[model samples]
Target: MGKKKTKTSSTETSRTVTTPTRPDWVDAQAKGLNDALTDLGRADPAASVAPLSDLERRASETAGGLGVGGGWGSGWGSGGTDWANWGRATPATGPAPAATAPDLSGARLEGRGEVPQAASVLDNLSAYMTPFRDQVLAAAMGDYDAEAGRRRAAQDLEMAGQGAFGGSGAALTRSLTEGELARGRNSRLAGLLDQMFAQGASLSAGDADRRQQASTAAAQLGQAREIEQAQLTQARDIERARLAHEGGLEAARLAQAAEAGRMQDALARAQLGQEGELARQRLGLDGAASRRADAETQARIGAQVRAAEQARLSASEQALARRIEMFSGLPLGLFQGSVTDSQGQRNGTETTSGATLGEIAQLVNSLTGSPLSRLFQKKGQA
Candidate 1:
């Protein structure tokens, strides 16, 4: 046999390539950050937020201009809405601020005045502002200290540059130069301290001014919001008054409509009942007529049956009469016979005989081949 050549499989011939790999933790962190960013990009804030319906929007519009800033409920009206409990006022937190009824004579709003928003803003200042002040102070101190450190480092570098490797005379001269430079640096550091102190004072004064400006702005904003709320409340009251007036007319119209609907329903029911009664009467009449016709047909059928039966009976009676007449024309004999036995008892028998032997033959012929006649004939033959 010739030598066989072996073929290598394609998978075995294929070379495996190795690539550079990153640390598992590094890859995992990068992947996680990428996934987080992707998810954030895809996320819809509106999906989480409930959307307002058209009706709700209308109600909100009717109540007040939407998105009016500040505490709308606090200054003018109540918290939440009155729609949940219609016709009722919100319960008061304290002894209900005595309401001053508006004077209709001038048509001017009552109790509406300039509210001090500055005082309100200043009231909460210490809680939030302390941290901000502390931060600013820290930043200024750090900057001052860093500048001082840089100056000190420069002085040390200068002294180091003046270092001598020569004899005592050179050392003394170097020492003199270093002493003067140290004095100058100390003077500069003192001036730097003074500058830092001045800067700190300026910062403090600026912060105070900023707080004052903020307070004034906040006060103005609050007053503006209060005015807006009062306007909304006034509009709401006007709308309520208008609706109240219309409500009375609506109630009367509804009452009339309800009464008319009830009357129409009653009329419809009466018509339906009348129609049902008519249908029932018609059905009853139709059924009675059908039954009467059926009864007449049955009576005619019964009469026909009776007539057929009477005719059959009459035919039978005539046939019997004709047979009787034939027998009457023939000579029929009544034979009386007596028999005596050895016991000395006498027996007598009576038999009716046909008038002719031909009649007797006819009767025998009619009974011929019957089971009882056959038996008698066999006996006679035997």
Candidate 2:
């Protein structure tokens, strides 16, 4: 008898894994965002302000000099002081000087001179007018007297020539002619006298009107002078009041500007401190997030490795079980057979039989027609 040999085999499987990568566009976008954040984090430069002009500088200096009691008045009426007197002028300790009337000596002199001249003109008017009237009357009467004398001479000659000068008719005509001539002379004298009187009255009335105009003009000139003086005094007072008010306003503006500057400085400091604290917090959060991401990645990788190892172990175990079952089903023992004698006679004859290797191979091939059997066949051939 010979011992049968048993064969053991094993198979190894290898797995391929592909790791995914980020696209080019995704990487570009992430780079751009990072650049933008960097730019935003940078500090800004300080801005510059324009210099003040000459007028502004002078105004500022003037305002600064107007401190408490420096000018205008004592302080701007702070605590316990009367607000009504903030920009008021100081009252006089004694009574103010009384306003005096404007000087009118020149006007008075002129008026005096005019009055005498008007009086003199009035006094001489009648003297000059009387002579002029006499001359006019003499000239007018001379022409009439010459014509009357010529007519009288002609009448005498005609009467004498006609020898009627000494007669009754001639005497009567002569008497009537003399009487008519006398009446004409009287009428002309009366008219000349009336015209002279009328002219004198008109001259006196004109002189009176001139005198009245001069007096009225003198009075109006004095009144205008007084009004001008009053206006000048009022203007000076108004100017003083305006200056005081402007000084007070300037002082108040300076105070308000100082307060505003202090508040702005405090606000800027607070903002800077807040920004620094926020930056620190952001750094801490970024670090924490990075650590958490790393931890998660490690956990995922470890789980994947563990799963792969378990699958490999299970496959190896299943292959080993199938090999064990196939080996158990094979008949490896030898068999012996004995032939019985006819008629139950005792005979000493026996037959022995056993399964060969080739028969065992055929039986195993028929029982397992799977890929595992082909794998074994290929290995055996190799």
Candidate 3:
């Protein structure tokens, strides 16, 4: 079988990135700042720093005096008097008095009086009706009696005219006539009595109606009065309750105001204390900063003086070394010579004059084992 075709591919990718450069002025400014910092670093501290003003000098002197004379330095190390207690004390404020409540005992309402009694229409009814009935009956009976008397006189005259005055027939007729008249009179009298009684009864009934109307009016008036009294009492009670509530509210308001005033006073006192403490701490910090600045200034001045002295000493030593080197370069005379004798013999002898430059160089090279020893020896032989 044929092998499957295989293919391989390779991909390459490339990208170019461009970076933005700073402006010339920016670079110049940076370079200037760097050079300025370098020069400041190399400059003398004493020359760079300005002299203290009069105020600052006085402050420094005062601080120094306090440190030495007032035991301020010792106080810090030995836990003595602290600087925090150097201010005026705050005054204490008292609490406000409580409010008084109003009296409520006088607000109570009084009890109402007893209710009025109702009037009766039948009161003394019998006595008043009896009198009226008797008067009417008497007037009716008097009229009946007068009528009977007139009739009896007329009958007697008629009997005399008829000639029956003293006979049996006349007596019998007179008796019959008297009897009829008596019957008629009795019937009339009875009718008159009935009418009188009816009138009396009507009067009594009218009086009773009047009394009943009066009694009802009185009862109505009493009920109205009672209602009015009840309303008045309720109104008074409501007014009392309102007055009591208002008094309580006023008392509470006064108390709240007093409490608020006390709290405000307390807060003011606390704030005053905090301000005093902060002032003290600020003063201490400022004094410490002033002392530190003075010390640093003195140290800088001393360092500058020491550096100047060191530079002067180094220059003097360099000058002395140069003089020594110049003197040493000059030729000295200490050399040995050969003396001639008879029969061509030579002997060693010391020379009094100074040696030549080559001899001195050779002597120095031999002593020091210098690289120039060969040149000096060759020159001396030449």
Best by lDDT: 3
Cα lDDT tens digits, model 2, 9-43, are 44444444333343555446556655654653462
How high is the lDDT of residue 343 in model 2? 29
Cα error, residue 101 of model 2, in Å, equals 18
**Which of the two candidates, 1 or 2, achieves a greater lDDT against the reference?**
2
RMSD of 2: 61.0
Candidate 3 — which residues are off by over 4 angstroms? Answer: 1-147, 157-183, 263-382
Better of 1 and 2 by TM-score: 2
Q: TM-scores of all models? A: 0.22, 0.28, 0.33
Q: Which of the predicted structures, 2 or 3, would earn the higher TM-score when compared with the native?
A: 3
Which regions of candidate 2 fall more than 4 Å away from where they truly are? 1-128, 222-382
* Rank ordering of all candidates by TM-score, starting from the highest: 3, 2, 1
Top of the candidates by TM-score: 3
As a TM-score, model 3 comes out at: 0.33
Question: Which parts of model 1 have CA positions greater than 4 angstroms off?
Answer: 1-170, 253-382
Error of 2 at 367 (Å): 99
Give the range of the ten consecutive residues with the poorest summed lDDT in model 1.
Answer: 91-100
